[model samples]
Target: MNEEKMLKVEKIRRGTVIDHIPVGRAFKVLKILRISTDPGVTVSVAIHVKSKKMGLKDVVKIEDRILDSSELNKIALIAEGGTITIVEDYSVIKKFVVKLPDIITGILKCSNARCVSNMESAIKPSFTLLSKNPLSIKCHYCEREMETDEIMDSIL
Candidate 1:
């Protein structure tokens, strides 16, 4: 008798998993999170995977490290409409819905070519969610223009 093994998603013992990230943004999220091949913690990321909501999305699996609110907030903007899950003992301990902040602060820089934040450290970058109409965000510093996803690239 021969039986094929079924493929199923495994549960992480203890870690934080950020899912529902927009497709093609997983690697960018990794960069923004400053995640590296650190020996101390394990970081796993998958991009362009099929998702019910996104139809294509990114997933970040982290082990042995828990992120704080600030970090999650930044990720929320990058992975807009994503969900953050804290797992322990293979069970979901907490589920948080990542939402678009009405006003983004100090997390992203202006895309304006001449924005002072680009040249001088004296200026810090910030933005306000102007309209969900086109998912556009306005830079508080230089009044630059960008969409939710564009902000991720600007920060990088």
Candidate 2:
């Protein structure tokens, strides 16, 4: 076994491992999870690593934190094919691929400034998944369509 060929990310005793993030999106994932702001949490990030399945990918290992459904939903929007792994006692427990929901609410703000969700605090932003390949979404209120870049900016 060649040491240079091996990918050696240290294992976490208990936490979450987000793998297969699209290249250059690991920072975005970190920002979304606010991992950097929490000084006490231990985090390891590998960017643009060679991967057989994704060609090139990013990985994030966060110590002492398990993602909730809302956090997973947010991750799914950015990392469509990424997988989440749960670790406990230095052992793999649960693993699954991220899946976008049909209808997402409050997680993303509509790009349209005049949209009712933005105009009225009482109304939560709502959007329906338009397409996954190109990553498009339609705002339920303004009926405006947002593509990948727009969606990335609109995350609340």
Candidate 3:
């Protein structure tokens, strides 16, 4: 029955398939990717679906679109345990779990309003990882600490 349901969205000839996103985060993932309702992009989102591994998770399939490393990093920040699969010719070309960088740069804004990155001259926001399991970061410029939730809210 699940296989039949899954078939509704036919396999893509090429592009990315992001699976095992935490439940209810498919939209946020879309937001992080800045996917719009543009004509050329075919994006499919499945939320709260049952997964043997995840129990209940979200999946996103974007046709004809390949994400870069920076975008993948943003995704890692949001969906820490998610898996990304790169597909071509309807075959899985590459598949791996997202890994957060030791030092995150420019993708998220500093939570501190008074931070130098937030205040003036082009100091790109950068954060040093404070923890990985329950991810926490500190602004490199201002030493402002931000947890996963805070940093998630600060995505640029």
Instruction: Indicate whether candidate 1 or candidate 3 has the larger TM-score.
Output: 3
Q: Output the better candidate (1/2) by TM-score.
A: 2
lDDT (C-alpha) at residue 56 in model 3: 92
Q: Number of the top candidate by TM-score?
A: 2
Stretches off by above 4 angstroms in model 3 are 2-9
Q: Write the per-residue lDDT of candidate 2 for residues 39-97, one digit (tens) a residue.
A: 98999888988887888899888999999999999999999989999999988899999
Q: Alpha carbon lDDT of residue 3, candidate 1? A: 11
Candidate 1 — which pairs collide?
none
Candidate 3 at residue 64, lDDT?
Answer: 92
Going through the candidates in the order shown, the clash numbers are 0, 0, 0
**Alpha carbon lDDT at 117, candidate 3:** 90
lDDT order, best first, reads: 2, 3, 1
- Show where candidate 1 strays beyond 4 Å: 1-8, 116-124, 132-134, 148-150
- Per-residue alpha-carbon lDDT of model 3 for 1-156, expressed as tens digits? 583368345688999989889888899999878887567889988888888887899999999998899889999997887999999999989999998888999799998888889887667788998887778888999999899778778998
- Candidate lDDT scores, in order, read 0.75, 0.89, 0.86
**Where in model 2 is the C-alpha error above 4 Å?**
1-9
Model 1: lDDT of residue 29: 74
Best model per lDDT: 2
Ranking the candidates on TM-score from highest down gives 2, 3, 1
Shift in Å, residue 80, candidate 2: 0.5
